[model samples]
Structure formats: structure tokens, C-alpha cells
Target chain A: MPTTLIGLDGVPYGLITSYAEKGYLPNIASLIARGEIVQMESTIPDVSSTAWSSVITGANPGEHGVFGFFDIDRQTGRLCFPQFSDIHVSPFWEGKKAAAINIPQTYPARIENGLMVSGFVSPTVEKAVSPAGWLEKVRELDYRIDVDSSLAQESMEKFLDDLYAVLDSRMRLFRETRDAEKWDIYYFVFTGTDRINHFLFDAWDDESSEYHKPFVDYYRKVDECVGEILSTLKPEEKIYIHSDHGFCPLEKEFYVNRWLVEKGYLEFATDSPALITDMSPSSKAFSLDPGRIYINAKDRFPNGSVGTGDREKIKAEITEKIMRLESDSVCPVARVADGCEVFWGPVSSRGPDLVFLGRRGIDIKSLVAVDGLFGKRIFRGMHTQDDAFLIAGQKENLPSPFHVSRIASLVV
Target chain B: MEYLDYLENKSIYVIRESYARFKNMALLWSMGKDSTTLLHLCMKAFMGKIPFPVIHIDTGFKFPEMYEFRDRTARRLGLDLIVAENRLAKYRGMGPNKAGASKLECCNALKTESLQQIVAKLKIQSLLVGIRRDEHGIRAKERYFSARDESFKWNYTDQTAEPWDYYRSLERDGTHFRVHPILHMTEADIWRYISREKLEVIDLYFAKGGKRYRSIGCAPCCEPVESSASTIYEIILEIESSKTAERAGRAQDKEDAYTMQKLRSLGYM
Candidate 1:
């Protein structure tokens, strides 16, 4: 029997379960009743690229090798976005007859037998799909990989409209593809949940909020689409539903690179340093978005200063210090793990030396030239490591200590 | 980024945290792939030297090859190795082959008791274990830092929540913590790391006449699986596509669904 996986990106366990229980998502509620649902853990950095890579590879960052959206190019000492090819392991459906649609971090999709349409980070529809012939059809269907999330900053109404339009296009693509192709495994991810959550998550449960109805209404429409999709599944076939990571209310943005400068761990040669490469040779450490810290080791970076022997001490000292970081009685960092311990594989040696897991309400970011230790952002919500959910068709087969890395095994 | 570096950094962090938190801490070395990789991590964390002692529970039934590998590796790594053995059990004729002893009973007497003796002797407050969640179902529930009470009984029912790396380092009186730095790593990861770091392991892991040991323990309790993977690269390749569990060759876990849990709760590493 063919297995179908419907990914509702960024939908948290509490939000979906509560919504399903309260009659806002009847289709999902019925699905939950027929299966099992639980809180699933995301990757350490808890970003879309890392979590989705884990989902496809069925391995931790150590095995799959993608730590975050961005990584320091060891040879150049320059930061670069890790693309689909950066993932080390063979995707779960490497040899299987499969159809993957709108899955994030899968830009420049590769498929042999069936179809594929990459999700986020995909610059153009022509380059995102396999079976190149599908390009014209995808464009004709008005398919969009992701809504311009930045639009929410200027106009919430236009952003909501974009979300609905993108979701509608996604449903159209899903319906058209399901009818056009038959495969052993079929996976389609709806990224609208994430786009809406990032902007309007605060509206949740607050009936008085201006955008509350639009927020809930978006999910209601999502429920109707989910029902339409489920109606296509065979009774004997399995299905899996999950999110890459959870969403949380963002209270403040912690400028990590700026914090490093204030703490004297980092030094920028230029006052208006827009890139980490502008860091002085004496700089000890730097940070990346969603809290990844890398030591400017002499062996790795061209302008490195920290010696190999001193790297550990500095990392431990920073880890201890970052754990105590606070602002207005709120500890920004929940934990700071030494990166080496969390990842292990052939390519792991180039990962960050330290990774910070932020506390709820704090979004850890790395804008190199930011002025202060903390700032507010246009984004109202952020990603969380825990609370990302998985609703499995066959609970008996779900991997224990449930994690996103093990999600692919349930289907492939 | 390389996944190994991430795991190495995290392991190093956990190691440093344990060292900073506890007055007396030690790492349990089994000469197995997991523990040996952990020893590498410990050494890397401390900058080419482990600040704490490395304890090995010599169960007497371990393979001669393992003993050789252990001694050679300890000396090579300059480890302050302390071999813990339950001589009293050996003297009393308690063994896996003994008429009245089950494999589990023998393990408790030989391995667990030996470990307990060493812990008491050293008054160690924290122990670094190389247990991974992917090893067995029971281990999947373990936190990075887990506690055992006065009698060394693991309260598996009430584990402290370890969200991210914010591990609970505190313990009550008469309790000690078991720190797992590699709890998130998988079997495939261990082999892949072994390849990446080029760490030495016992030759028993390699295939002999189409048989290879996937996991190493007591000589009698551990069986070699049918395979032709003689090199570390081959092992990684084997692990990536292998359908069998990592511990499928070990005997104790085969006794029942809860055998490992029972053993672990009773202080077995």
C-alpha cells in the first residue's frame, strides 16, 4: 500500500490538538482520532532547513550533516547557505517510486521515476522540479513555493491574502499531481501554516485581536483542504502528518553577534561591519541566525586567532556565560550545547563550535552589524525545538523518543 | 557543516559541563566503538588529556582481543585507566555459564557489581556513559543527565526534562548522575565517526570469514553477525543500509523486552 505524508509546516502540537479539539479543524480532528499524535522534537537549531533535512535523511545533523540554514565554508572562512546537495545521506526515498512536493530545503529537486517540486529557498519554479516537463504545468497552476513572509511587515492584509493564495495554489498542485501520478510514496508539505504563524501567532486565542479571525479562518480553510486530500487516500494505505518545527510568541530578538562583541569575544575591524568576514583577526567567536556559534579557529578561518588548544576553553567559557544571559528578568538562552557533541559524521568537523537553544519569547539572531544586544523585529513568532508535532497513521511503528529525523522511516 | 563536528562540539560541551559541575567524575570505558569514540571526545574536550579517570569494568568474560585493545588504547591515549573487577563473584564461581545463574544475573554480579564497587571506592559523583538512544528502546527515554538514588536504582519513571542542552546537573543526597554525552547519536553515527576520527577499535568488529560483530560485550554473550565488512568504511556502509538493530548480536537484550531497562534501572551501564 502507498503511504502518504502531509506536512503542515510549523504547526505546533498544542496549537493543532487544541484547535482540533475545539472544532476549528474538524478534518484534522478526525485524523487524530483515527491515529496517534504527539509532540516531536526538532533539530538543535530548530530551523526549517535543518529540521526538514533531518526529516528527509532520517538522521541527526551529525549524520545528515546540515547544521543550519547557513554554514561557514571551511576553506574560504565565508558563510554560505547549505543547499539540498549539502545533505550527506541518501534521502529515504532514494530508490523508491516517490512524489515529493513543496518540501523545504529540497530546492533543485532530484527524482528518478516520480515527480518532485522543491519548497523554500527555491528561486524559480523551473529549477525546483524534476521531470522538467512539469515546469509549464506548475507555472500554469500558479504554483508558489512560499509566500513572501516579509510582506507581513508592511501590510498584514496583503500577507494574509498571499497566504491564502499560496495555500490555494498548493492545494491545486497537490490535487493535480495526485491525479496525474501514481507512486509508492507521496509527500506534500503545506508551508502556509509557517508563513501565517510567523506573523499572526499572537492572534491565537485572543478573540479581541484585530487579525484573530483571519488567523483562525486560514486554519479552517486548511482543514477543508486536508479533508479533501484525505478523501483521496485508500483505507489500507498509511498516512503521516507533521511539522518541521514549532512556533512560539517572539518577545525580543537577541542580536547574538552584537552580544559577542559586547562580551569581548568578538571584534569587528569596521564600525559598519555588515558581514562576519569583516571581523578582526583577534575575534574569538561569532554567531549565526537561530543561535549557532563558531570559533574563528586558526585552522578554519583565514583571519582566525584562536589556537586549537585554546578553542575548547573559550567555547566552554562562552557556553557557561551564554547560559546566564538575561534581559529584563528573562534568560534569553535556555541552553548552549557544544556543537561537536550534537553532531558526528565525516563532515561534522566544520560545524559550529557552540549552539544556543533560546528560551521561549526570545528569538536568537545573528545580524553582524546590529547596534544592540537585543532588538524588536517585524516577526512576531519564532521557531521552537520542542512542541513540533507528528501525527502518525500507525503509532505502533513510530520511532521512540520521537524526533523529526525518524519521520521518513515511517513512510519510506 | 560536518555533522561529526556538531556531535563532537556537543559531546565536548557535555564533558566540560560534567567536569565543572562534579567534584569527582569518571568515564566508563567498555572498549566498544561507542565508549572509545566517547574517550576521543573526552580527550578532545580537555585538549588532548582527560582530566578525570577512565574506569573499565572488567567482567572477566571479555574477549582477550578486547583486553589487548583496551590496554594498548589506554596507554596510547595516556588514560588514567582503572580496571574494576568483582573478584568476589569470580571467586564464588558466579558466571554466565554457571548452573544457577542466568545471563542477566551474571551481568549484574560481574559488571554492575564491579562498577558499584569502583564508584563507592572512588566516591564518584558523576559518570560519563556512552549510551545512545538508538541502541535500544529503553535508552530512548533517557535524559542527557539521569540520576540514581542511594541504592543506585534508576527512577526511570521520573526523569528530569532536558529541553535542549540545559541538563539538570543537581542531585539529591546519596544520589549520583549518569551523564550521556552521545545519547542523541545513532549506531550509524558511531561508525561514521569512527571513520572520520580514524580512532582505533578492536579487530573483533571486523569480519572474520564472513562474520562480524556489530556490538561487542562479553565474549560469550556477544555473537558475530554474518557480514563481510572488514574495514571502517565498509562498516559505515553496512550500518547505513542494515535492517538489524545494533544490539541484535548481544544476548542480554534478547532475554525480554524490558531486560535492558531492568538492568539499567539496577545500575548497569
Candidate 2:
């Protein structure tokens, strides 16, 4: 079967379901009627890069060895962002001929049984696509692989312009390239939803807010792209519309490492280095973005004092402390998943000791030298679990919280 | 009169100003089209003989033709050239192809640290580079004239804004400024300038067999794109008509979301 999967990053079932219910997203509404709509569970850290890697390869974070967006190199103790080459297992469609575009973290564009055009986080458009000349074709369609994100943070008008521009060019390129090539499977992702949601999500429901129009306007553009992709679907072809993860709004930053310091777990001598990885040798624990807590075990960090045998005990203590620690202004940390259970793979040891899940309104930072526990965020949106939407054409019954890797099966 | 002419005039003006502002100023020549073109602009700005020397940080992994071009061009132009290499690091087995390190680490060990070493030793108050805003996302965030601390770290978040070409060149005694003479030029404008000036481009740029180098870096770290445009006119047509990023073939930028930003922060051009 020639399946088409369109990934809408950071969109939840509630927004799509409600909007589709009201006729705002007609294609999605129709897909729900004829297909299965289920909420999906993204990877534990729930970062876009790792989530998309899981979606590409049917393996979990442990199996794939991609734990988070950025990982700490166990040997060098350096903060390293994982790339396409870092993927441990062969991608799900490794052998099959496929066409994938605008998928994040698939940089240095992989050349396998088909074409791949890596999107955001890709260094250059030339290296962003495979088979060489397809890059020219993508550019010819006026596609912008990476949006000028500074505009989104600085100016709303420019942000909307850039959002629509990317959508239009992406739609044109996807359609043009889909017909231009023949493949067993064609996959595309619309990231503007995630970008727009981050900046204008608070104004999404507020009609009086200045950002309300741009919010709905961007969604309408996404809806139009989905509709266009749907309208061109072959009679025998079935499309899978889904999101990597769900979106939530965050008002304040939760400084996890600072909290760890407050609890006397992590220590620093001279705070010359600004990052968590630069902590002093005696430091027992540290944190990374999106609330990942790592115990600086002897073997893990260069000069870590905590031993491997004591890993479990330290993790347990940190988990309890993190769960109990909360600020009045910040949303409480609801659930903490042990890193051992959360991450499993050859490189899983490099992952954090605990993966902290914040309440809806909370977000985590990896700051080691923060001024205080409470800090306002420049951007408003964040990632949430159990909010990802997956609509498949198969008649088989699916679980409400379908796994992200399950979509990898439909790609082939 | 043309876009290229406007860009060239702006670059010439910027180059002259940097020469006037700092007694210790040098242009970084990477032996690539952009830097080679910048060299030609320097020759034009200084009336056939650049007053200051040129610096080229050799990572020891460059294409053989690059070294040839560097020596030949310097000799022919009667220019003072200083070739720098981190031989100690390379001898100790530090390379882009080395295992256990990410792309950016290799770049820092070979490029950024090497440049910083030379800059501090030479005490160059300002270094002129041929960086354009459209090259990469990180480059887009830069000003025409950027400053770096004693450690060669660029404070990207707290960068000062420039109005009417007023570059804030003042910095602490140990600190230095990076004067970008071609920050406003586009990739197309660069090709146009090269074509108009009749500058000699490296042979790697012209297509041979089936591939051509778009952005030249170290041999192990750089890859070539598929292009049939062997001549200057064909290259110009290929570039102006296509939207592929020029530095896409360069491998260092793929390390992460902020690899280039980190490299620039650590003092890599």
C-alpha cells in the first residue's frame, strides 16, 4: 500500500478534534470519520528530535539510542546534539523506497532506498536532501527548510508572513516532488503548527487578543495543506495524519539543576562555565533541558564521584526530592520516570537518571547558574504527553495511547 | 550600477574603514571563492598592495589545490601571507575524521582554537572576514562589525545594533573586533563580483567528471555537490537561478542546531 503520512508537530488531539468538530479542519474531520483517531505517546523526554527519530525507526529511545534532543557524551562529558549518523539502528524504511521531506534531525541527508530531505536543524539545503538534484527542485519551488525563527520571537507580523510562506512553499514542493518522483511511500511534516503554537498559542482561543487572528489564520493554512494533500490522494491510497507530540502552554521556567543545588545534591566550585556539563568534579547530579536529571556517576562523567553501584539509590533520592520540590509560581512536578525504565539502549547510560514530567503549565531548563527558581519564558508553548494525535486508515482497532514508533510500520 | 557593483562599493568602503581604524588589521583568506574575492577587493582598496598582512589558518586537511592557490596567489599579488597550523593538535591525532568527538569538537580543535591562537599572538585589533548574512542562520545574527572578548567568545545574545554603518569597534585591551566587509552581499552578488573582476577561482569549483565543490573546506569535512556548470558563466547561472545554500557542502555546520553559532562564538570564521 502506498501510504502518505503528514506529521503535524506539537499539535494535540483536543485542538485538532475540536477544530475538526467545528468544520475548521474539514480534512481531519473526514479522516476521523473514516479512520482511527487515537492519542499517541511520544518518547519520555518528549523532544521533537528524539520523537521524530522514534517515529522514523520503530524503536523506543532506548532501542534507538537517541534519548533526548541533546545528549551528554559519557566519555568526553560534552553536551552533544544527536544527528542522523547517531541513529543506532537502521531506519524502519531502510530497505524500502520512500520519499520523506522536512523531517527534523535527519540532517546530512540519508541516502537509502529512496529520497530524504531533512528539515529544520539541517545545516544547509544542499546537504538537507539526497539524490543531489532534488535540492534544486525543492529550492525551485521556493521552499524554506528552516524558518527565520528570530522573527517568530521578535515580530508577530513577520512571524505570520514567514509561517505562511513556509507552508505555501512546502505544499508546493511536496505536491510537485510527489508527482515528480515515484515511490512506495511518501511522508511529509508541517512544522509551522509547532512554531505558531509556541508564540501565539495563548491567543488561540482569545478572540479579543491581538494574536488571535494570526493563530487561527496559521491553523487555517495548515488545514488547507492537509486538505490539499487529502484531495490528491489515490483511491487505493490511505494517509496517516499525526503529530510527533502534543503542545502545552508554559508561563515559567523550572530550574531543575538550581533546585538540585538547593537540595545539596549538585555543587559547583567556580561557576566559570555556564552549562550544566561544566559543573565541578564533586558535583553528584545535574540537569538538561526539558527536565532531565542526571546523577554524575563515576563512569559517566569525567571526574564524577558517584559510583555505578550507588546509581539506583541516588536516582531514588533525587526522584523523591524532585517530586516534593515545587514553587508557588511554577506548576508542580507531577510525575517522575526513572531514567533506567525510561531509556534503554547501548547509549542509555549517557541519559539522565530521572526524566521529570512537569504539570501542564510548567517547563524545565538546564540552568546551573540561574538567579532564582521562578523565571518567565519568552515563548509561551511547550511539549506535553498524551496529547499527540494519530489518525490511521486501517480498520483495525488501535489503543488510545498508540506508540509513536507504531507509525513507522505504516510508512513501509 | 548593478547589484554586484553596489555590494563591491560597500565592501570597498568597509575594508578601507577597517584599515584606517586599526593599526593591526589582517584579512582572513580561506582560499575559497568568497575569501579570494575579498583578497581581490583588498588589492583594489589598497591600490594593488595591501598595507597589512593576510592570515590563513591551515587545518592540514585542506585540498592540495588550496595550498597551491594560496602560495601562488600571494606571490603573484606581492602580498604578505602568514600560514598558521595547529601542528601539535594534528600530530596528536586531532582531525575531523577522528572518532569519539563530534563535528564541532573537531572544528574547534582544528579551526577555532587555531584562529584564536594566531589572533592573540599577532595582537590584531581587528580581523576582516568575508561573511555574508545569507550564508547561515548564525551568520545572519551578526553585525557588520562584531566584537569578541579576550577568550575569543562572541556575546551573541548581547550584540550591539548598528545603524547607518556605524560599527561599534571599541573593546577592552585584550578583546578584538571582527570586521565583516561583505556582510550585506548575497551569494549571487559574490558570484557576480568574481565574474566581473575576473578573479582566479580554485579548480575545485569547476565541475569535473560529475561533481563540483560548492563550499571548500577540509577534504575530509567537505563534500561536493552535483553540478555541470564548469565555466564562470555557467556557475553564475547555476547560483543565481538556484536557491541551494552555498555552504551546504561544508560538514561543520551539521553538528547541531547551534554548531555554527558555537563555532563563531569560539572564534571560527
Candidate 3:
């Protein structure tokens, strides 16, 4: 029997424990009861692309060189959105047949064996799946490779409706593919769980929240899907149910760029959309998504100011400052490690010098169009540092303090 | 020295390359500024006459002026025009008027399905489309010359690489390709080119009662955004200051999270 890995993209462990405690998710509760649970840890930034790659390749961000959805080339000072093709190492199931579906950051879909339907951020539809024949089979089911959730900015109702429709279609696709293919390993990921949390997470805590029932109802559907998929697995086959990272209700959006400007570490040439290269010559440091700080060392950037001897001082100072940060709606920063400290291998020089992690509820951002620290937020949920857990029935040689990357090897 | 000239030159380069590469080629004319600009580039590419046919995947629900302008321009330019529609699909119940499902369903039925049928019917090996990267998030990741399988499915992630003005491997064994002459151009570039070429445009783009269609699809799904731009120059100025994305007014894209991706995969224009 083949191992089946069911990834609930961003459904937190805490959410699952609570839902199971209340008997809302009996299937998940039963899995926790049987499978050995390992508190799975995500990457430093805990982005979908990097975390998923880690799980696929059985390596750290240091080894795989995918820090986030995007990467900045230190040589040219140009930013590049890295894709699945950028993964240096082959996946754990290399040369083995596996049916992979809807996994985020796996676009430009590739597999040595088996079929792959690339998930989010795919550029085109034809290339998202391999062996051109599989394209129509997936298309006929009205299967969408991704959801254009940008519409949610204006209409939440349409967003929710589409999410539900996608969920139902996903279940249909899963069963269709499962029955059709004979594979050694099967993998499927659902991104709707993350999208729902981003929009209606406030409802999770507040029963009176307007979309409360819809939110809970969505989980119930997820629960039903889990049960259906799990029941199909044979007694000998193993199952792994997990999420990439946890989530908490978001309140204030903290603009780290604004903080840098206020502290006189960064100076902008102009406003509007602030690019990293827009920093003035006198600027000492700049940053990118999810709290990545790069010290503008002498000769490093075109407008580099900070020297070699002064980098550690600058990194230490900013680390302390960001760590102590707290405001009315924002919680205190939990961990503020240097980028080099967080990621290792060849990506150190190309990566950030400082990586900061803030507590959940305060959404973190690098760009600031306005001259302020706090800003308006459209989203209600934010990624938390305390990531979710992974439960698997196979109990051979598990790392006592295992990371999520090890999950791929456990099945192999 | 003008930016518009550089844009025209680049677009002309793409158009010439597409013409030289593929045999069974056609161009898409949406009767909008982007596709109209593409036509202008096509004329320039072949020196005053386009050798290939221009295709318009008509849904039969466009603005009246669109039809009028399309006919007027097609006659004026002496274009080898071919209008493709899935009338059978429409007769079998499509369009927003036949609403039980989403407007997206109608799009899939009437627009995407129709185009796929027409292309296969013509045995079109390639199409010269006017898709810009800035139009939608899904479009942002498209290749200059994108291939679709026999099923007309676009693989967004698994696309071919373009290196130094060279798009490798002109044809595939079991797939057709779409050639985007203006994939790199922005919304602002289209207006600038329209001004430079003195091209005729759909009147819906200009402000009427303090609003204009930033993006034109079908009459029912398209909405006009608040604008004061009355001329091409003013529209360029609007593009410079506009905060909203060009496709924000297109309703079908917002029907679900991935409607655009799904539509594009199914060969929707």
C-alpha cells in the first residue's frame, strides 16, 4: 500500500486540536489517536514555497536554497520570484511514481515519475501538468490549478462561494485520480484552508462573527474530505496530515521599512512604490518580505554605506530594537535572528543579514507607501511562529525533535 | 529616442519573429486597445499588409460600437478577418442571461469553449494574441510564445524559456502555441502606442459621464471605473496615476479565486 500525504496548507495544529476537542473533526481526532504526532517546524519565514520544498526535498532552506516565494540576487540588486524549477536537489520520490496534485510552489510541475499538477502561482495551464494527455483529464473535471483570490478584496461572498466550489471539485478530482492511477505515493494539497483563514480568522474566536458559521462549515467539509480520503487508505498504507504553519487573528500591519526610516537606517529617494534600490546612498540597511534585513555594506550595493566592521553592530542593534517592538494592537516580537543565523549553506551571502519574527496578530510588511509604522490591513489572519504538527502511522526511525523536512524521507 | 518608439520596435520584433516561425498562424482581435495596438504592430511588421488572418472570438454580446468599429476597421485595413464563435455552445445555453451557474460558467461555455472549437476546426498551429503581463496576475507569468496541448490547456508553470530574442523549438508534437507580441507592454504602453500610431480606438475607453472602461471584455461583465480622461493623452495620464489594475473592471475574473487561471487553461481569450 502506498503512503498518502494530505497537506492542509495553513490549517494550524491549534485549530485542529480545538476542532477535534469539540468533536467537529472526528476523523482528525482518530488520526491523532493512532498516528505518532511530531510537532513539525517550518522554515524561518515559514513561507509556502520554501516549506513545501523542504517537505518535498527533505532538506533545509540552506540546502535547497529556496528561502521564500521570491529571491533577491545580490550581484545585480534585482529581485527574482523563484519557482519550483529552482530547486537544486531532487525530491525524495525521485524516479519513483507519485501522484502529486495542487501543491503550492510546485508549478512548472516536474516529477521523474508519476503525474504532477502544479498548484498556486503557476504561469500557464498547459505546463502545470506533465504528459500532455493528463491535461484534459484534469480540465474536464472543471479543476482550477489556482484561485484568483484578488476578487476577495472587493467581494468576500464571491470569494467564499468560489472557495466552497473549489473544495468540492478538489474532492472529486482526488477520488478520480486515486481510482485512475496506481502509484507508490500520493500527495494532494488544499490552499482554500489558508485563504479562508486569511479572510475570516476573526470568526474562529468570535462565535458572533458574521461569517462564523461559514467558517466552521468550511472546516466540517474539510473534515468530511479527510474522512473520505483516509477511509480509502488500506491498513498497510500510511497517512500524513499536516499544515505548513499556524495562524492567528491579525490586527495591525507593521511596516518595518517605516521603522528603518524612523531609525535613520534607511532613506527613500521617492515615495509611491518603494523598491529596495530606492534607498539613498546614505542608507545603511534595507529589507524584503516577512522581515528580512540586508545591511547595505560598502561596495555591496551601488549606494552602499555601511562598512565591514560596522555590520555586526548594525545587525545586533536592529535585532534588539525589533525584538523589543510592541504596540497597542501588535504583540511583542518573539524571535529576531540574523538571516545568516537562520539560513545556512551558499544562500548566506545572497540572503538577508537579519531575519525577524513577530508574534501572530501583527502582519509584517517591508514596503511602506505612507510615512508611518502602523497601517490599514485588509486581511484578518497572520502566520504564527508556533507551526502545526504532522501525524504519520509509520514509526520507523523518527527524529526525536523532527522538522517537517524529515516527513518526505519517512515515507520513502 | 521616444519610449513609444522603443515599445513599437520591440513589439514589431516579436511580430516578425512569430510570422517567421509558425505556419498556421492567426491573430486575435478583441476590438480593444491592446489587440488594436497589436494590429498596428502587425501592419508595421509586414510593411503595410498583414499576410495572415486576424481572428476575433466573438461571444455575440459585445458593445454595439465594438461591432461597428471592428467592421469599420476591418474594411479600412483590408484585413483577412475570421470571426470565431461557439454558436452550438451558445444555442445549448450559454451567456450570463442563461444564469444558474456563474458568469464564469458562461465565459467557459461561450468564450473559452468557442475559441477552442474554432482553433481546432481551423487546425491553427499558432495564434498571435495581444495578452499583456500587467492585465492579470495569471497573465503575469506567461511566456512570450506559449504552447497549449491538443486539449488547448495552458500550462502556466511549465513554459518554455526565451533567451536573447530567441524562443526555442518552434513547434511541439502534440500542442499549438500562442504568440504574444505585446506581452511585455504595460497598460500605459498601449495608450502611448495608440497615440503614436494615431490608431482608431473603441469609444468606450474615453470618459463618458465621469467614467470609462479601463478594460473591455463583454458588455455585461465589464464595468466602467471613475475617470475624467476624455482623450488618449488623458488616458495615458490616467494610467500614470491609476491605482486600480486594468482588469479590475472585468467581472468574470472575480467570480472565483482562480477563474482567470481556469479560463486561460481552457483556452479563453
Question: What lDDT tens digits, residue by residue, belong to model 2 across residues B215-239?
Answer: 9989997899999989888887787
Best by lDDT: 1
**lDDT value for candidate 3?**
0.76
TM-score of each: 0.61, 0.61, 0.59
Q: What is the CAPRI rating of model 1's predicted complex?
A: incorrect
Q: Write the per-residue lDDT of candidate 1 for residues B1-269, one digit (tens) a residue.
A: 55677777888898899899999999999999999999999988888988889999998889999989988888888999999999999999988899978999999999989988899999999999999977875676577888988888886645534533557899678788999999878888888888888888888899999999988999989889999999988887777646334323453133222322321221111
| Candidate 3: regions farther than 4 A off | A298-305, A324-326, A329-331, A394-401, B1-269
Measured with C-alpha atoms, the lDDT of residue A97 in candidate 1 is: 71
> Which 10 consecutive residues of model 1 chain A have the lowest summed lDDT?
A72-81
Error of 3 at A356 (Å): 0.7
Any runs in candidate 2 off by more than 4 Å, and if so which? A269-273, A329-331, B1-269
Per-residue CA lDDT of candidate 3, range B126-227, in tens?
888999977885675667788888888876645533533556536887678888889877898788878877888989999999999998989989999999
Error of 3 at A140 (Å): 2.1
TM-scores of chain A, one for each prediction: 0.96, 0.94, 0.92
Could you tell me how far off, in angstroms, the CA of residue A346 lies in candidate 1 after the best superposition? 2.1
Point out the higher-scoring one by lDDT: 1 or 3: 1
lDDT of 2 by residue, A21-87 (tens): 8787777788889887988888888877778988987777765677665667655566666778667
